[model samples]
Target chain A: MAETTAPAMAPARPALDETLLAALAAAAGDESGGLTRRLAAQVRYEAAETPSRVRHLWRFTDPARLLPMNLTAVTGAPGDVSHTLAPSVAGAAATIDLWPGLPPVVALSDDLPAGQLTVVSAGETAGSPALAADELFAALNEAAWNTGIGLAVADGARLPGPIHVRVHASAAASLPRLRLVVGRNAEAMLVEQHLDGGPETRVTGHTAITVGDGSRVRHAIVQVWGQGTNGHLSVSTKAGADADVLTVFGVFGGDEAKLEVRTDLAGKGSRSEIVGVTLVTGKQHGDVHTTHRHLAEHTSSRIDFKAVAAEHARSTYTGLIRIEDQAHHCEAYQENRNLLLSDRARADAIPELEIHNQEVSCSHGATIAPVDPEQLFYLASRGLEHGEAVSLVVGGFLENTMAKLPDDVRTMAEAFVGPRLAAIREGSA
Target chain B: MSDALLNPANPANVFACRNLHVFVKDGDQEKEIVRGVDLTVQRGQKHALMGPNGSGKSTLAAALMGHPSYRVEGEIWLNGERVDALEPHERARRGMFLSFQYPVAVPGVTVANFLRASLAARRGTEIPVRAFRQELNEAFATMGIDPSFITRYLNDGFSGGEKKKLEILQMLLLKPAFSLLDETDSGLDIDALKVVSDGINQASGPDNGLLLVTHYQRILNHVQPDVVHVFMSGRLVRTGGMELVTALEERGYDWLTDEAAVAEGSRT
Candidate 1:
């Protein structure tokens, strides 16, 4: 695939002010141009559009209101971060490393098979996204997407183990798009990890997944995108006939994260399971918006999202189950639950369902509640202090959804969440 | 509870509650669950509070631990220090433990991790991981619990026998200054009851006190009680030795409630 530098010619809209763009560019060190360029595209497409109000949390406004994207994240200093597979699980046959301004670094193991990887431009994705790129950051990612990864697993092959994809985002706007294409009757798992150093890191990530007929695929996005980074991600998936797709989002640390995930069941008898676990504390804000669309007969999808927020932290969840007219005999369910860990912590849950066919079975439920008192009492009466008990509860709350993640990915997620919950407990205590 | 470890100069009692009353909100009113109850458990003494269902035995145990759901009044002293004003966790830090009748499930927290955290909090320091694991494994073996319980979530989806065994397992691990066992054997099978009773016996010593809140005397046969208190209508209507448990088992609680009514009738 040829790299296209020429902008896709299209109708003009409101673009970012020249002065503001220049300031954004000047404030960003090595990442200035990319930030300004993406912001420009964002302003052009989304600045004036009216946003849907059904599941809105934070107010969307000018780029000036976003968490800072101009500061630079220190890169690869000693003790910063390492890009490698976990020590316990060692069977990765191939690895892909991504960062800003650097070509993707790929290394193959001795057991790697042929035609497992390729590269393609954004325009070449076979089907349109079921979820529109109308959100400001999502739109910006689309208008500015220059490179993406294409992973193909052959029929009846299981890749031996997961393929590790390490993404390094800077304080500037680092937008990465990934497409995992599992061939017919294949099985595979992808573990995508995000790493950044912060005080003011900004990241916008996008992922596309397509599971071929009768195939099974597990995709995990582990976001340790800096302790105080501002980030956004959108995941779009399509499942073929008789295919099974599982997507897990393990969000650890970020100042503010807006995640949008949508799964499309377009083939008969296809199954999709979307799961997410988010841990936020101490002035951080995380929002998750997900949609499961059943577009074919006998399709089914289950969406489970759980979050823990503490010490002035806030979390918002909005999930939708949409069933079309021809999608009869389908089953779809969405459940969102939040645990408040401090007096100042807040959670908002909104579940929506849109069914065009009465024959379809679609249901949605949401709950925002304090940690269960009985659970706390049981732990505390066992000699755990309040903070320790709360930490245990918070860990448990987040892991209900984490159990769906691949084993290695689950371990990584636990490593990030355990300390985070402990920190939150200490802060509150 | 054993009477073998009492110190004369100091307060030898492991736990004492004087005129304790507990009220919980029901609709628009505070309904009293424990009314004017006085109890004392000396170090090395095993006392059983036996009563029928809804007779406030569990409420007394809960109130003794300072459960937030109930408004507790009067004085509760543990190891000579008054702890009525303490939070449940604070009371726990002071070496008080309540084996819940219905232990809540903490869905994703593994049993081993939960026990380790609790033990650390009780000890005021961290327990080494390897040592903690070894101790937990031993407890599991003693309680006749499968090794898989170490990784399973606390009380989450456990069978009745498993949950009951876990309560005793935790009691053994924490080894509080005073442990209140609330209906710990109600849900256990015959073999499970024996295992739980044996674990409780192992956790017991002269330096600590054990208070068993039970509705059946079947478990008392396994873990013998030195003192027995008959509870009825949210109050201690009668107190005696192990003979009281045998009497209640043979005669039931009707006579206790009848005696209270006659006493009130004559006083009025």
Candidate 2:
């Protein structure tokens, strides 16, 4: 049995100042609209109580670790943001540059067809529904987001390639927000990456995605922060009738990180699939939580999450599926598998299901174990070296989930996970 | 070790083992499973080691292949090179292969990918994708396996017959100089048995040696053996031609065990 240690006392939660909130609201244009939303979010953030460790969502990770030590925000100078456009989507997609304490600058490609897509500052879309304020970090992001963007795709627009959004943290504390609205019968792929933060940087992010009826959306969030950086992210998605949504979440770099995803099947015959892959080595830590709520009849959802832990790294996964009484004839499946590559590496998995209707079919399973020796021996007997055999096994373990990603995203994931798997020694466990 | 045993007079001697003893750890005690034994197989020669259950026939084959669980104290030579000290993969790279009685399943790894990697490791270079795919397709046709199995995980959720056929398929790909088939025919049906036997025959040639370990004589009907050795109580007691297999089938193993006991008593 592994040794047990007493839990460390939680750090103090960072305070939110009304003066700073007002300043941020003023800098974000559309004073009448943005200020009202910011003030409401600030009130919600202050009114909410700190979550206790007893809550399953906050059980493995301490919320205080996600809070930045300093409360000051850093605003980048003009022209500090860099952007890249893939050739395939060069004509169809537009780029939006967001910086703290400045209005967003939108650049439309010359070949972009009129009325096909709308790229604008989030402050202009003030009538859009506000993000849920029950969570601490999400409310913090809503109240003090320094960088924000809103993207709207016209109905029946099919993008040739994925739109890329790269968020670079320029300071110790940063808040980023993104809102996406897909029109009916449209198809779009979005890739959001978090990068360029230092060891002590702490980032809080919130993303809200709304899909229209009979539409398909593929969204991927790849987080590759510095070795000692801390990140907290929340993603909430809602699907219309017959809409299909696929979300891929990849975590490769960070000292401490947490991601929470919630998908609501609000339309009849809608479907949602969520795939997550996390690789942690050394003393890094990763925690992921997902919830699928079926609100309409004939809705379905599937969640598959896998994590590989090496050295002394630790990973935690908790997934829940809830079927309401009105959600008759719904199907939900959740699976979480963890691979431990070292004797010191650790993994924890919790799968939960709640069904209020007898007509629903729901199943969930979780497994945590080290690599099988028989598997290694079998590969070795086929002439592969020990290192090569181990690499093959680990790669295969992640391939099932990674294969579901977009082509470019899958390549990026391999670039991040391949080297870490190669560095592991034979029989290190 | 005598010079004659180390360097056999016949240059065609493809595989030879001298006084091989295998021990497995059970808790804190070392349990001897394979008593000291000597055997030799020349090129184009097929040998069958017949024994009853719990007689350690599988242990000898595994120990000869350098399985990490067994403590082997003996010399195993393949193609005139000693390999007992090498790792299993190293031995495999040097033309040694073992078809396990119970093949393990590797989830998330496709059969095509595994075969490509194995071929690459054996040849010391990556095989071209197109050529590899063509070869895999041909092998699949010969093994009577569906081409769809190429994309399926290796042996995962495979039936008993399918697993056995895959083992033979691997043999056809690796083309080891010496192949030790441990109970390859145990769970195979009649049709699967014939197909696997045909695959084994196709892989065997004038330059390689074959050693089949089994407790049943059914598989021998498909793949004939040139030499048959009766194993009892972890030792090879009698070695002869095909007559031994027929005798064991008609008379069973009790008579052989009685004679072997008397012979051991007199020698001691």
Go through the candidates in order and give each one's DockQ: 0.64, 0.73
lDDT score of residue A152 within candidate 1:
66
State the local distance difference test value for candidate 1.
0.75
What level of docking quality does candidate 2 show? Answer: medium
lDDT of 2: 0.82
Question: What overall lDDT goes with each candidate model?
Answer: 0.75, 0.82
How displaced is residue B113 in candidate 1, in Å? 2.3
Task: Show the colliding residue pairs in model 1.
Answer: B1-B44, B1-B45, B1-B46, B2-B44, B2-B45, B3-B44
Location of the lowest summed lDDT over 10 successive residues in candidate 1 chain B: B1-10
- What's the chain B TM-score of candidate 2? 0.96
**Predicted structure with the largest lDDT when compared to the true one:** 2
